[model samples]
Target: MSFFYNYSANNQGLEIEGVQGQSVFSVAKGKVVYIGDTFKNYGKLIIIKHANNYLSMYGFNKNIFIKLNDQVSENQKISTIGCLDNNLSKLYFEIRFKGNPINLLKLFPNIKLKQH
Candidate 1:
């Protein structure tokens, strides 16, 4: 998991470094709300809306397996990790509640985010 930074800093997500083409999974069961790279600096991004006004985001994907409005299950493979302009393979993951970013590490204390 990445270090914490205030929302205004634009560091609202966790960067999970991994090998190129590694699988990326949905954090929970949700409906795909957005699927595109239009968001600046978030390459090939996918957003899912979960219950109780929660949202999950997966970014920097090499390939996306699901489409917009797709109902995805927990742990479902959504995409493959992609490289940024610097050529580093990573997945930018985030969770939000009511439009505010939440600390993932605090929420899943025992979960491992890094991939080798």
Candidate 2:
């Protein structure tokens, strides 16, 4: 789904469905600022702060391999894909600038997003 997808709660990111346990990689090099499952709806989440006041979020992770404050490189395996209550596996990703959500497609025009 696109970042602007509307649901019960506003979707602030892009969602990519995949098989359970698929690898999830970081989009850029940054510090792992937050990593936890506290947000019930997000599952195990990881937020990275990058250069130029950008932040990337990776949600619905089954397992997170890195810890907070760790430096991560682009394409690094950070977590495994997680499933929803109905057993649908997906990765919820977002990129924010100055605390506002930005459309992933607008930023990465080369990405071919799947439409459901």
Candidate 3:
């Protein structure tokens, strides 16, 4: 790991560490906009566009169930947790309002996100 990566953790998005095979769900109702590993450190990523110009990103996914333009519901199963390394998986989740990353928990205060 580089020195920047170690220090940049604070600025990065939320990380939910877990093992493989854990289910990953859509945090909001939206249409699947993009899916792939374009973000190098994120492994497999999914970007969904929701109403009111909000976007939710579910990253580090191993198995994806939704495709481009697919209508997704809140809490719907979208994928399975993916490896962050050779032995562990994690979900790197975030929210964006008009393309600006925002504090996810501040917006979804009551969301009961699962942990591993």
Q: How many steric clashes between backbone atoms does each model show?
A: 0, 0, 0
Native-structure RMSD, model 1: 3.6
- The candidate, 1 or 3, that scores higher on TM-score is 1
Candidate 1 Cα outliers beyond 4 Å, as residue runs: 1-8, 109-116
Estimate the overall C-alpha local distance difference test score of candidate 1.
0.84
Estimate, for each residue in 9-50, the C-alpha lDDT of model 2 and write its tens digit: 455687777778999999999999999989887888999999
Score each candidate by Cα lDDT: 0.84, 0.83, 0.77
- Sort order, lDDT high to low: 1, 2, 3
Evaluated against the true structure, the overall lDDT of model 3 is 0.77
lDDT by residue (tens digit), candidate 1, 1-116 = 33332244654677777889899999899999999989867799999999999999888899899999999999999999998889988787888999988877788677654433
- Give a tens-digit lDDT track for model 3, residues 1-116: 00111114333357776668789888889899999999887789999999999888877899899899999999999999887666766777777788877865666566555542
Question: In candidate 3, which residue pairs clash?
Answer: none
